[model samples]
Target chain A: MSRIPEETLRVADRLAAAMAREMRDDRVAGAALPLALLAALLARALYAPDLVVLGSLGLPLAPSAWWPGSGFRLSLARAEALALRHADGRFALEDAFASVFRGRFAIWISPAQVDATGSANLSAIGDWRRPKVALVGSRGLPDDAGHIPMRYYLPRHEPRHLPAAVDFRSAPGRTPEDGRRGRRRGGPEVLVTPLGVFRFRPEGVVADSLFEGVTPEEVTRRTGFPVTGLPEAGRTPPPTAEETAWIRRLDPFGIRALELLPPREARLAAAAIAEAEGEGM
Target chain B: MLASLTDVAARVREASKAGRLVAFGGSGLHRKPLRAAEAIAEAAVPDLRLLAPLGGPEVDLLVLAGLVRRVVFSYVGFEFLGVAPAFRRAREEGAIEVEEWSEFAILAGLRAGVLGLPFHPLPGPATGDLARTAPLAEVRSPYAPHEPVAVVPALAPAVAIVHVPFAREDGTAFVPGDPYADRLVGLAADELFVTCDELVGPGEVPGPALFLAAEVTGVVPAPGGSCFTASPPFADLDVRGAIDYLESVEARLARPSARAAPGRAGGGRGR
Candidate 1:
């Protein structure tokens, strides 16, 4: 019944495939990403009126693609202008925790590393004093996870990220002993990776479902901790053709393609050094 | 009265020497009055403590210049780029004192200050490292002693600097995009200085009034003041320029005499 284009659907399909699981609620707040964009479109398609998507500064209101190395840009200039003109619609970063605490707010966060228990690290790798790599420091993950329910999104499912324990507990997940704390302040509920969907359980993380063409062994191999209570290997439901077409209509520029590749590879490939070397020769 | 950018910076420098705490507006590269802050750093005033809700290049530049003695902030990093090199180096060397608060705590502290409240209570477990080091104190709820709450002390900075798109001679400032915590910073500070791309008459300013003239101590017109940060209507974030600045900073840090190159601090334009 929808008149959405086929090309748009293909792009949305890739995004929806990466973010396969359904959210508990239609409303969410998070930094802009390909998966987050897909979730927004999915929420809209479901006719959810409470859909409120909050983006960080300069993040596009809709799905966008960064030029190979230029970084993210608003896909539509008009949309960018509109967003700027209605700037009051955007929430203040300082009020982020207050919103989470006020309740009926769900957040989808992507951290550098996540452990089996749903604990996350966005600060650093290795020692805290002299880290092997220092990432953007913990912004609101600690308070958000400590106060409200959160979901995780990992575009690249790798062993390093799905570690047994995070190098830093930027945000502590729910544990058996943390029942009282968890009840007072909700914790992470589910994790959606490129390969599959996982739910954090008191026992450990259990596989909710695996993406099509992805094997249980592959998921287990990529994860650092043993995935307990594997749900009878079910296929991640694919987005319908109509849904994909509608998403493409929403994002005409195929911005979702940028996320299809690993960030490290993309950065290196788009590095100024490589471009300069080519130009010099 | 409209003041020159240098005069504004001089005011900040003078205040810093008195060991006053200063707050800065914006997150990442949005609405940061970096040029004026850099000017303050270049002045090399001592005993200055900074209170930033979120940190970026402005904080890094100050740390690199050894102008800041203490900093109260939630996080300090270059966002997706990497850790703020100067902040990391300073922290590792124990060159500066840090009062780490969670992002919410900083905001709540400022809000409490604006409202003239003693402290704002945050609901959560206050057992984290930041909660231990910061000014947050645990107290039994008066309504329910069983319910524990973390209360963050109110923050009243001596001065707050923010960048806006436009301003009037009377000191009213307008922000084209999200004001973030600029308004809160303005209200919480004893004195507020706003740097804008354009200076106009009272009625000519566009957008909502982000900072009232009564609270604003001064307004200075400095085009492209945010530079690498988005000034909007004026210019978008100069990402290429930011990348260039980051590369230069990295190169300088990698040099053998990197520590001796403090003279180069505040030499470059805002980015």
Candidate 2:
């Protein structure tokens, strides 16, 4: 932020307003606003692509509506949706995750599991209700693109300050069964819970806490998901509002991939869309 | 062969039979009923089986009205159609078969049967548990590496009825986008009949190249069925309607298929 030239800064009105609206807590409001402003300002200068790091806010917020295991119960339904629609394997999941972990994909786990991770996983970027992210297996987007809609599910708990347990299936990496069956080839590093934020490292371990603004405790309390640990201390900033706006205007920045929403939600949304479409309105 | 959306609707309505089921969809998907193509579906599919991937409130009127019987699909299309009470009832009663199928497999299966394959191996991403849960993915040689065939048992209908914006006299048809699955249904059918809003010759279309292959056997010239599919030259989509349709289909698709041998029985023969 210090290096950014003053003239290059994009207005932070939308970002600021969104933050203000999203975070009702005053205590954290000051810091979040400034951080967002600074990051957005800095993003004006940095080549967003060169910015290997991302300060994803899908992370825990002071008052977030998302959590880790929120998708856990919904996993069955979500998994069912994916299985049903994806059995043929035409579209790719935004997140390369296996929902059941050790079991087959069901719509619900025990209520106990839901209590473990609190977030609902509805906090995907932009308007995407069921977001998916993937590697640029193809060539990267245009150089100026800002965000790659990489949908990852950070566990509710990390080794330490973990406020939430994350779902890794939402990240990179192929599930074991998928590997055995040769379905999804690999696994994801970081995760984007409806609440928590994460980033991947070259080392393969998902370093937590990519959303610089919110804390695990705050996020956990807000989203009811326990997000543990910050990234190895120095996380890269996210694209500022200017960069985001620029990318939106100049390029199709985000990855179009996303995973299925919890079954109930997905069913509802798809039904709404389908029904509306069927009506021919 | 030349017909309009309304003409197509009459054909579909005529194709309906009691206690018999037929799958209906187009390459151009729609969630709303206002579009002429979807209207064709509404007009044709009601009081019969609306066999789709899913259902929702959107088509509840169709469902509850007893106009729609059972819907089979992956997701509820309620949002697309408009919320309805009938679909919900069907779901509660365990009437719809929502077994999932991969987007590709759905198309490929139809294609394979049309192309003269017993089953086409559909080895791809099974996002939800539909592959294991759905009957569509159950086959002797599903995605076998050697053949990699997705056993698309011939989805031959007593009548492969479709509503397009354009129906040509030479059995050529046109719809929006590359309606690949429609082509599959067109080819692997005992008969391919169509209804449309307008009838056009090869001269009316961009070129003869745009017409589907010969498999689109019978071109029944009818108009006004372009409501669901967004058959171009007649209409485009409002997107909101598409969203609503997505939701309805999602709901209707909630029912899983009773998994059996993929092609245990069917109207058409597989390669």
Candidate 3:
């Protein structure tokens, strides 16, 4: 494993700890924290003086209304309320989607699986006639990836999740060559996984940065195919203290901490248990 | 006139008898017409084909009860809870057929239906192999013959069942959240049935009209009708209940003897 900077490790630890602390509560769902944190990050990255719609599964209310301690009202209704409050006028949902497709807005989606080429699968794991696993059908992903600029968030980054090729192409990624069928302006831009960050390139996906303590070898081992053009390994930029504080403010109940910690630690614990069993036996 | 939940189910049954396509609403538990769906499935209407953007417990229940013979949808699984088990079993058993569309295709198809067009042209990968088995046809662009375009045939549901936050006695309804494709489905369907948490007098309706009275065929007051799902201020999705239901269905499906249960045999209502 490549050595991770102490500071970078600390940042991942802190974020994981915060997520762990938030998970203690019974009400919060498993993906809620990471998703909310991702939402907050996206909101921060895209925030501007003018109104820009953040197209997600739903809308996000003001931090005060739906943040961690506020009972976390993360629903379509909450988003709708926020959209109504922020927009200058009313329009149909289709119009909003059309705007997103036209690249007038940005969207964040979580797919079941994504491949090196950026093709996503949310429909099935095997043949269409009878799938080994039937997932929620592809809603909007085809156009979302084909037209709108999208950022994908994968909570778990493993060979199965980030495969060499998705079993079924629910959404087609940008072609390797300039000549392709997708939108001229829109396609996948970035992928955020637990281990590292990647950006889509004409040739293929390239590793932009690794999280603290994650190695290029580790990433490649977990990935289905050999990842190309990994830059001289650098620490992923840690969340700024200000950004951390803003995240805390957005999730007053500390839900992010609780939601993130258990799984992170559980994996470590399992590894430790396996190591001990091997040594002792 | 205000209709009852049973009446709405009967209407759905009538549509089913006529071999009409039915479309429900929403992604998850939010804003779906669950009670009406359950009632329709319980009525044991056969040859029912469903056209929905997303599927939830109601769809699963109908599939398990053998009420739905075919489904044309984007996706069909319980969010977070995992894949809808009954749907998986039915698909595995080849008891039902599916015409899968990407979320974009389903929405675009509905738009085309509303426009009274034969098909809607779409760009990108959805036009590729995914369109092979689907009702999509490829056509050369008049301006650019070298560029191939995909055209998705319009999807017009015979009956659309939608659940909203508020509806007037006159049949116009209001949904406080993202209507998703509910409005388009309503507009594209031959008949629209709306179930609302609150029934209001005409002119007292709030927000924009999600479903116009002229377009809506029936207005039913069904408070908590979307129970175990969500209808906003009326109720939140009963997560515990949903998990319990999933477990129950899973357990029942696991039993060898239970495989021949009345629910799966097209006789009784699924618990």
Output the number of the lDDT-best candidate: 1
Number of the predicted model whose TM-score against the real structure is largest: 1
Cα lDDT, model 3, residue A54: 32
Which tens-of-lDDT digit does each residue in A55-157 have in candidate 2?
1111111111112222111111121221122122221111111112221111110011111222111111111212131100101110001112122232233
lDDT of each: 0.66, 0.33, 0.63
Task: Arrange candidates, best lDDT first.
Answer: 1, 3, 2
lDDT by residue for model 3 over B177-246, one digit each (tens)? 6576787889888888998888887658577678878988888887766766656555544554565567
Alpha-carbon deviation at A210 in model 2, angstroms: 3.6
Candidate 3: segments with Cα more than 4 A from true spot: A1-37, A40-42, A45-91, A174-183, A252-281, B123-129, B143-147, B259-271
lDDT of 3 at A28: 12
Question: In candidate 3 chain B, what residue range of length 10 has the lowest lDDT sum?
Answer: B262-271
- Model 3's alpha-carbon lDDT is 0.63
1 versus 2: better lDDT goes to = 1
Span of ten consecutive residues with least summed lDDT in model 3 chain A: A24-33
Superposed Cα deviation of residue B226, candidate 3 (Å) = 1.0
Instruction: Show model 1 residue runs off by greater than 4 Å.
Output: A1-21, A28-38, A45-49, A55-82, A85-91, A94-98, A127-132, A181-183, A238-281, B46-48, B80-82, B92-95, B127-129, B260-271
